[model samples]
Structures are given as C-alpha cells and as structure tokens.
Target: MPGSEHADRTEDGLSIPRHRVLVTGATGLLGRAVYKEFHNNKDWHALGTGHRRARPRFLRCDLLDEDAVKAVIRDFRPDVIVHCAAERRPHVVERNAEAAVDLNVKATATLAKEAAASKPGAFLIYISTDYVFDGRDPPYGEDDTPEPLNLYGKSKLDGEREALRHCPAVAILRVPVLYGEVEHVEESAVTALWDQVQEGAAGSCMLDHCQQRFPTEVRDVAVVCRALAERQRQDPSSVRGIFHYSAKEQMTKYEMAVAIAQAFHLPASHLMPLTEQPAGAGARRPLNAQLACCRLRQLGLDVQPRPFRTAITDCLWPFLPDKRWRQTVFF
Candidate 1:
C-alpha cells in the first residue's frame, strides 16, 4: 500500500488505476505530444525515452541499442508502452535501407518482445504511416493488404508484422502527414513547408498538385494515444490490431501550401504547382495516400481528428502577431 495513491480512483472519479506508461521516440512530434499528455495526467506514471534529451521524467535511450531497451524494461517494467518512433522520411530511408530496417523493423520487434516478456497484456501502440498502401488505392482501410511503394512503407509494414508477432495485443495506428508546433520551427513535414514559405523569395515552394494526403493534427493524435493507453490500463480488450486515424479532408500539397500561405498572411503567388515528383526525391511518393478513421468513429471514441484547416490555425498561431491577426479579423 506504499504507492496506493498512485493507483485507485480519486473521490472526483477522475483517476483510474495508475499505469506505468513508456513512450518511445519522446523527442519526435507525436512522441512529444504523447509524453506530454502522460506527464500531465495524474493517473500515469509517465517515462519517456529518446536520444540526447532531458525532460522531467524522460530517459535518453536509443531504441537501436538492444542493451538500452533491455535496461529500460528491467528498470521500469511499464504496464503500457506507446511506441511512437519510426523511420519516416521516404527519401532518407531509401538512402539508408539497412538503417531503416533496423530502426523501423528491428526496433519494433525488440520493443514488442520486451513488453510481452515483461508484462502480460502490456499495451503497445505502434505509430505507423499511410505509405503502407501503394497510393494507387483511395481511402485504405485496416483490412487492405500492404503494398508499400518505398522503403519507408515496406519497413513500416515489416515492423507492423513484427510487432503483431511479438506483442500480446497491440494497436497499430497508421496516420497521415502530421502538422504541429514544436520547439523548433521546421520539426514536421508540414512545418518544414511552412518554414520554407515563411523565409524565401517569390516562387520558392513548388508542391505536388496531384498527390493527395490527409493532414492529421498531432494534438488530436496525442488525445487518441491517451485514450488507447488509458484503455489499455482500464480495458485492454477494447482496442486491438491495426487501425487508421487521419483527417477527414483529402488535400493536395498544392492546396496545403496555399492554405499555409493564407493562414500566416503570406503571399501565395510564388507557390508554384508541381505536376510530378521533384528531381532527386530518391523514393517514389505516394500520390493517392488517403486514410479513413471509420474504425475509431465506429468504436465511439472521443476526440476525433479535426479538419486540416482548423488544425492549421493551431500550428500557425504561434507565428502570427496578435495585433496583426486581430486587425485582419482572421478566425
């Protein structure tokens, strides 16, 4: 009964049984959000692991190191582990295929096996991507067989299988291009484009006009991860297997760039339209990678992903001047 306060429900009926939640890739976008959510929640014994970072309860452990993974498992014994790390950049993965496999595939398998061995029914939520599909299909569902066009997708699909094989019961949440605000300006793919638009001459950004993507909000994603982690603690049987969560809107990179330009009161005349993938892109891009979140909706989960336009405001608010925004009467 020493740490009983950490467990058990409070008088207000807010706190559930406290769970030891370990989030991997705590330094990354979604990982940071997830870790922050866990850290803020009083019901979670949150511990984050990443490389070369120091937060309140964060550990600096590289997932590629097997000894480090084992050491974390031995020391923490987390009841629920949310794995938000992966080799995401398609071109980067193409250049380093072996490293991709090691990070995306081997790291997941290691974590899953460790979780299974450490705690029975330990929930592992693997953050996957829409690249698992060939992009030829539209609105890919959970049942669709993976046909990855690039190394990143293939590595993620392989990682998915490995996690399924090792973890007791896991939620493989596949997301789309995420946009969020971070300590740095160009942290995510969307923000990278935003940063490009923010600082450049006319006609700087030329984005793909035809390729479609669901611009998922990282805050919405963090909310869902919190639900899954808490459900894993309260009712592990509720969520299992592969699921997709993305914005309802299907936007072109061209449209997204235009939106970003408009959101921050920047000129869009310079944003050129791209018909094909740019030269030296390294890997083939997913031209039609749209994801549907019907599963989460069907399950009646709270805090679904918001429209990309609304999420855009959340990302750009920090960059906008209060009086300038007030003068323009921008919502």
Candidate 2:
C-alpha cells in the first residue's frame, strides 16, 4: 500500500475493494518490479511466490507442478493473479521443447483453470511477449494476427489461448524486451554495455541491423499491470483480450547501443558494429518486432512518448557503479 494513494488516482482508479493478490515469478526482473509496486498497498494484501528463494511474503512454488499451483490457488484464494513466469531464451526453448511446454504452456494453463474455478470474479493477467509475431511487419497492434516464428512464441501463444479459455476475466499483456536492474543476471541492456566500457573494452555497440523493436521497461510494465489489476477488480466485464504495452518509439539495436554509450560519456567510436547473423547454430531472429500500444493508451494507460534512447538511459542509472561486464559476444 506504499504507493496506493497515487495508484488509486489513475484513469481507471481503484475500482475494486481491498483483497489479497498473488504475484508469481516474484524473483524475476519484471516480476520483482511488480511485487515492489504492489507490496505496500494497505488496501490490498500482496503475497508472492518464487521458484527457489523466498521473497517477503512469497511461498516456495514451482508453477510447472500442477499440484503445487493448485495448492497455492486453494490456500491463497487471491482475487488477482499476475502470471509472469516463463522460459524466455529462444534457443533454450528450441533445444528443450518439453521443459518449455511444461513450464510456460502447461503451468500457465493450470494456474488459469484453478484461478477460474477457485475465484469466480478473479482477474488473471498473463505476461506474454511481442515475439509471438513473425516480424514481417514493423509495428504490430493488439488485433494484428500473430504468426509466431519459433517454439518460444508458439508456447506463449498456447498459454494465452489457455488463459482465455478458462478465465472469463483475463488480460493477456504482450510486452517486449524487459530491461531493469535486479541482480547481476537481471541487468538491463544499457547496464550490460556500461559494464563492458568500465572493464576497459572498447565500448560495445550492436551492428546496424534494420531490426526495430518497442522495448518495455520493467517498471513501466509493473505500473500498467497494477493499474489493470485494479481495473479488473472494479469492473469484471470491462474488457478482456490482448493488450500491447511498450514505449511509443521504435529503436534499432544499434541505436539503443549508441544511446547507452552516450549515457556514460563514452565515445561512439569505442562501440563496434556487427551485422545480423546467426549466433552459433541457433534460430534466426525477426528483423522487426516493434509493438503498437494505441489500444492500451485508448484505455487510459500512460504510454511513455520519449524515444528508446531516453528510456535506456533512465534504466542504466543504477547499474553504472557495479563496473562489471560479460565477455560473451553476440551480434
């Protein structure tokens, strides 16, 4: 309830009364942000779950295990369940299809069904990805038909379908690359680059790939999720379907690298450019995965209008002091 007063004054406002909420994937980057956003609300009781380590109120739970998930649903009886857990590495999913299915698709389906049965009016928000599209087009809207190119996208699409089928009140939020600071492993793109520069490597830069994308910051997504959760509590019949949430501007990976270098006063010359090519023998990536957020804005969500450079700089502020870097190179 720390930011409740401000959170309550949003467009949809706090429509639902006080109730307990459950946040899965509480230890992940975006999940941690969401947990922080809702943790202090006096009106709503916030309980979270992590796969291994215990967060403040988090209970140990592996979402892939249906019995464990069902037990959480029965015990917590949350009014709102925000599902942010998933196996996101594309090649990893490609290599281990069954684990991906078990965790991303099966676990999500289990949670959705249990939430629907346990709490009739509960709202279930599934965090999905913009990679669900084939990326033939540059900017994709909410209603645009998805043509997923890989196993990761296929599995998430499957989860989305399952959520819609079982949960009457569900919000499938498709977001793009989530960047933020949590642990060393959870550092943002900007942070990763800054670490490289601090390590005395010629500052790093991405190749001039034509690929464009709408990157969603971890904090911003958390804010929207909390807002939507409140709205669902207020009006169960409001609306239900896919919602795109991301920064308004589209930025190429190279442009993003330049911005990160500038944030720390590094010379652009220090950054190297690499062409688009397969890393090792993995899946080919989409050249353009930008998302359109008009529907979310129409619904009164605050979409940041600045360019991605500004957003990247903001996300990099906290991690500059760490001064660490990864030697693994990618284009």
lDDT of each: 0.79, 0.74
Encode model 2's per-residue lDDT on 240-303: one tens digit a residue. Answer: 8889887765666556666666655655665555565545547555677778877677778755
Q: Write model 1 residue lDDT over 227-278, tens digit each, in one string.
A: 8776655667778888888877777878887887776667887787888776
Candidate 1: RMSD to truth = 3.3
Q: Using TM-score as the measure, which candidate wins? A: 1
Model 1 regions more than 4 Å off: 1-17, 54-57, 199-201, 278-280, 320-331
Candidate 1 residue-pair clash tally? 0
**Residue 236 lDDT (model 1):** 71
lDDT of 1: 0.79
On the 0 to 100 scale, the lDDT of residue 10 in model 1 is 57
Candidate 2 TM-score to native: 0.84
